[model samples]
Target: MVIGIAVIVLVLLGLTFCVIPVVAHRFGEAAERAAETEAIAQGARGGVLAEHRVRFKESAAEMAIPFGIAAVLFALAACDAAGVGAARVLTWIVAAVLLVIGGFVTSGQLRAAQWTAAAFRRSSDPVVRGLDTEAIVSAAAREFPAWLRPLQVVRFLLTTVGLLVVIVALITPSAAAHFR
Candidate 1:
């Protein structure tokens, strides 16, 4: 039962932290690029450029659902309501892996957003210049809640702790039994 629950949680974490964001970011990038292309083609200004910015913002907002789900799962795990039992070590290992992957994904997204914003800033086009690049970039990069931002450091700490726990659980049979 514990293994089954851990598997389910792993699948959910993978989808929530990995698959969903990649898809959303790609689609959002496509939409933003398409809108920019159209605007440039039409020599348009203001409305379409604004929509392009909105697309970036929307893509960032798209993460809210996954974040919410993750938060709920986190709360459940914290409360020890996530089927903690014989598979505790497995659970911790899976969580550490997921956290590492999630960190990469999140940093990649932020870097992409910042790169895109930099490109816009460097553009000679009047339409691009008219839009507030700072606001757009902030919207894209500020996907996490303000309070949650500080916890970014905690992610690394937790990953280290999780890894240590897994190591201890592996090397010591008694510790492994305790984890179970």
Candidate 2:
């Protein structure tokens, strides 16, 4: 029973660490880029300031859906009837790699945004110059921030945890159904 329960947990963790992050990254990118573009169209300064308001909100919203669903699944798995195994160690390794990449991505985002903004500012056209420095030009482009380091670490941790979850799922020596 313990093994089965663990397996279920492992699967849920897999979705959380793997699937959820991908979806969040994708949609969040869209939301941010779009919001920035909209901000520029309306006229704003302090590019950072312009993007902070609406784009931030949109990015969070875009990311929340998948993680929220994964959370629910985790809860469900926790109440399952059996124990799980420890074979999921492999998946964690993969998750760690993904997270490392994610870290680079986060840092890259900030650099890219800075360069893009600088380029826009240097353009010879006055209209482009007048377009609001703080506002984003598109939905897909924005600064990622240095905080990605922690996120990368967290991702690595989660991958390790996910492996443990799979182990639990496979070992299932006991059952906690009806209530844990």
Cα RMSD to the true fold for all candidates: 8.9, 10.0
Which 10 consecutive positions of candidate 1 have the poorest summed lDDT? 147-156
> How do the residues 1-180 of candidate 1 rate in per-residue lDDT, one tens digit apiece?
333343344344434443444445655565555555554554546455564444542366677766664664454354333334534545455556555765565554445545555556666776664555445444433453453333433433433444344334434544334345
In model 2, what is the error at residue 64, expressed in angstroms? 4.9
Among these predictions, the greatest lDDT belongs to: 1
lDDT of 2 by residue, 1-180 (tens): 454545454454546444535544655555455655564565543353343333332344555654664554454454333222222333334335534653454444435446455655765655545554444534443434334335544444444554455444433434323223
Model 1 alpha-carbon drift over 4 Å, by segment: 1-44, 47-86, 109-115, 118-132, 138-148, 151-174
- Candidate 1, TM-score vs. the true structure? 0.40
Candidate 2 residue runs with Cα over 4 Å from true position: 1-61, 64-87, 109-180
